[model samples]
Target: MLLAIILVTLIVLIMLRVPVAFSILGTGFLGLVLLGGLGHALPILETAPATAVRNSSLSAISLFMLMAQFMLMSGLLDSLFDAARSLVGRIPGGTGVASVGAGTAFAAVSGSSTAAAATLAQTSTKRMLSEGYQQTVASGLVASVGTLAAMIPPSIILVFYAITAEASVGDVLVAGFFPGLLIAIAMVATMYVGMAFQKGAVPAGQRSTWAEKWKSLWHASPLLFIFVAVVGSIFLGIATPTEAAALGALVALILVVARGRFTTQKFLVAVAETVKSTAMILAIVMAAHVLGHFLTETRTAPKLVQAIEDSAMPALLVMVLIAAFYVLLGFFMDQVAIIALTVPIVLPVVEELGYDAVWFGIFMILLAEVGMITPPMGLNVFVVSKSSGIPAVVVFRGAFPYVVVMLLMAMVFLLWPGLVMWVPNLMG
Candidate 1:
């Protein structure tokens, strides 16, 4: 009863618009006091921030954020989008499809879903809307494609999951490759289908001349190089994710300087943004750790796992319930908070039920992606709205089909876990 009350109170606080970090921290502090007295709780509160900050993996968050900020400031994604448009924009729904491609390409170097959505939304929405595409389709494509960052390699969410779950960061990063590709393909397919049935959902784009296409490609090549350098280093076992992030940030800085786009003010802004984002993420990590410690003291995970095992529920059904629970929770919570709060309680049950942690990470990322584009609290949707000057409801409307695609992808993973595990297996 105490545990239930604690969880319900935390949920209520989140719904009441309390800052997530503070809500989690306060709830955890209260739970710890109730369970183990102030003496036990005080030590954990005092120590969690330091311990979490000590994780070297946490530094990658800042480095990757810097890399992404530099890329955005360099205006390189503009050329990348042009190149993708030149290559595909002549087909029906092509601009929308190009947005997906650009998002995928950008996700290789960007560890953030919001950054991907905002950058692409700013670039794609105007072109698509100008070309007669519907507002929802234009903004929604940007929002849905942004979620590609969540499952793509170099994803910050994957890094956080690895550190929290004590799984191999390398394996978890590699595991995302195929499932990410699967989701991207699904997004494109959803666009194509919408174009078919909705007529003007996406209008055909002007074709680029061969000369223009080559020029666009030339301008985009540098950004592509950064992607190859960062992701290739990881895929080829040349560096850890942290090393690759540093290399990518350095390369981005070099590229910006080479292009004469580097400004001290912009660089400082990037660094400041990196610090701000890193602090927010780490604070959540610290709070979640405190809460997790309290939950563990209550043996909640073990008890939950035992209950599932003793209920005669098939492993597949249990997995479905877990996925569904994540999707529902995602409607109300941010992905990082969802992962931090639930993984501690749910992961052991998943492992006991014979699911691989790496595979489950991919599964959870898919749910996260869905959550990012869902109605009401869809962060990416609102980002797209703000970036494109479109209404949030329009973005959400456009995202509905893509949300179905995500749900279908989740089912595909449930049916064949190997799709999520194959690349990671190749990592050995």
Candidate 2:
């Protein structure tokens, strides 16, 4: 009965358009008071705000965000996009392929899927259209690739998941690489196949000279270096996640200064934006802690676990049902909010089923990413529409194939968890 009230009140608040952090915070605070009186709620309310933000692991988010901002200020994304185009642009629907490459590269730095979608929509969509690619194909590819921002390393979502799951941040971040790479492969192949079978999907263009490819690759090498240094350092035990982030940010800062792109305005903007983004994430973390406390005290997740056990359902079937529920939530909520709300409840059940928390972290993130391009909210789709003036419906059609690809990949990941854990295992 108490769990029902907690769930219902949270739903009502979310439906009323309350901010997620506020909604979760209010629901938990009120639940605590109701469940154990003001005596219990007051101390948590006072302490959670401080403890949540004080997490040492969270510093990595600020640094990685700052690194992305600095890289943006220096215009590195354009270099990476141009380089990808030079290498891949001759293939059928090649510009669309390059957009995915650019999107994933950008994702390596900027963890926000919406930011990746908007940037690529502005930068790549026009080129894909000018290159005689189908509008649906061009727009859909950009929107779809944005979700990669959540899957790639240095992803903010990974950090959030680490905090919530009480898992190793480095392990979870490392685990994303293979799955992210596989998804990228599938997305790119979908483009190649879609263009090849369908006449007039993409008009053939001149192949790039070897010289042009080399030049573009050379110009983009530093961006590649940053990605390697950050992830490699963490993988090789040379730096902790926070230290890797600092190193990445420092390199980005130095690069901008050397390139004469550093400006007081851009620097200030980066810092200010980092502060804002960090604060917002911290709020969600704090609220989630409060909510987690309420759930734990009420023994809600344990009860749910026991109920499932009592029903004697197969673990596989139970996991599939949980996956479906998460996807349904994805339609309405972004990954961060969903993680904050659900991880506390779902994680114990997941562990009880003999799954690794690090693997589940990647799994949860990959599922949330699909939501970015799916309908209703489909935040990435709207971002592309707003930036590129592509009709949402057209983008939706474009994204549909990738949606199929993601669903298939989710099943693949579920059946073979080692695909995610292999690198993390080596890193250990």
Candidate 3:
């Protein structure tokens, strides 16, 4: 009953606009006090933040964030869009196709959905809009593709999930690659189909000559190399995610300097942004650790698992239920907050069902990402709308089809878990 009350309080706090970290911390500490008295709760409240930050793997968040920030300041994201456009902009729905292509590439370096969407929206949305593409279609396609960042390697969310679930981070990162590609291809195909049926949905581009395409590829090569080094070295076991992130950051700094755009101010700006993002992420981790402690003390995970098992439902059915829970919560809550709050509860249940942790990590991220493009609170939709100067409803309308594409991809991953596990298995 105490657990039920505390859970209700947590939900109310979140609904009342309290920050997730504080919501978790307050509810958890209160629960701990109620269950164990003040003496037990006091030490935890005192030590939780330090213990959480002491996690070595957590350092990867900062390093990767630095790598992404430096890469962004270097102006490589624009080059990525241009390169993809040069290669594919002549096809029907070429601009939309190029958005997916560039989003995938930029996701490799930026490791952020918001950054990828903002960059493309700022640089490509206006041009695509000018090219006779429907505003909703163009905005939706760009917003949807930005979600690739969540599942692609170097993903911040995957890193946090692996840590929370006690899974191998490297394997989790590797597991996302194929599923990410599959979704990317699906988005591109959906774009093609949409363009096919609608007249003047997308205006054709002047096809670039082979020579021009080659030049564009050459311009994008440096960032591509950094991406490969960061992700490749991790897959090959040459470096930890943190070490590879440092290496990537260093290479990005060098490239920025080489491109004659590096400045002390720009470097400082990157560092500042990295610090801000890292701090926010770590705060949430600390709060989650506290809540996890409360959950452990109450045997909440075991009970939940037992309750589900007692129902005698199929494992796949249980998974679908969990996915539905995530999607429903995602409509109203931030994805990161949803992951932080629920992973502690759901992960043990997932493991109890004989699912691979890495596969579930990828699956969970895809589900969370679907919420990112869906209505009422879609962050990507708002970001694209603001960046593209389109109405949010227009962007939301555009994003609706892609949301279906994501849901379909989620089903595919569930049906064939090996598609997510294959690359990670190969790494072993």
> What RMSD, rounded to one decimal, does every model reach?
1.3, 1.3, 1.2
For 227-282, candidate 2 gives per-residue lDDT tens digits of 87788899998999999999989988888998899899889999999999888888
Q: Tens digits of per-residue lDDT for model 1 on 1-428?
A: 88988999999999999989888989999999999899999999998767877888877777778888988888888886888999998877778878888889888778789999988988888888888988988888889889888888788888888888889887888788788888899888888887778876666667889998899899999986787777788888998889988998999999999999989999899989988988888889888888888898999999999899899999999998998899999898888898889998999999999989988888987886788889768999999899889989888989898899899999999899989999878877
lDDT of each: 0.86, 0.87, 0.87
Q: Model 3 over residues 45-159: C-alpha lDDT tens digits?
A: 8998789889799887788788888888788778887788898888777777788889998888877888888888997788788888899788999999889998998888888
Clashing pairs for model 2 are none
| Segments in model 1 whose C-alpha atoms lie over 4 Å from true places | none
**What lDDT score goes with residue 181 in model 2?**
85
For candidate 2, the 10 contiguous residues with the lowest summed lDDT are 89-98
| Clash pairs, model 3 backbone | none
Give per-model TM-scores.
0.97, 0.97, 0.98
Clash count, one per candidate: 0, 0, 0
Candidate 2 — what's its lDDT?
Answer: 0.87
Error of 3 at 8 (Å): 1.5
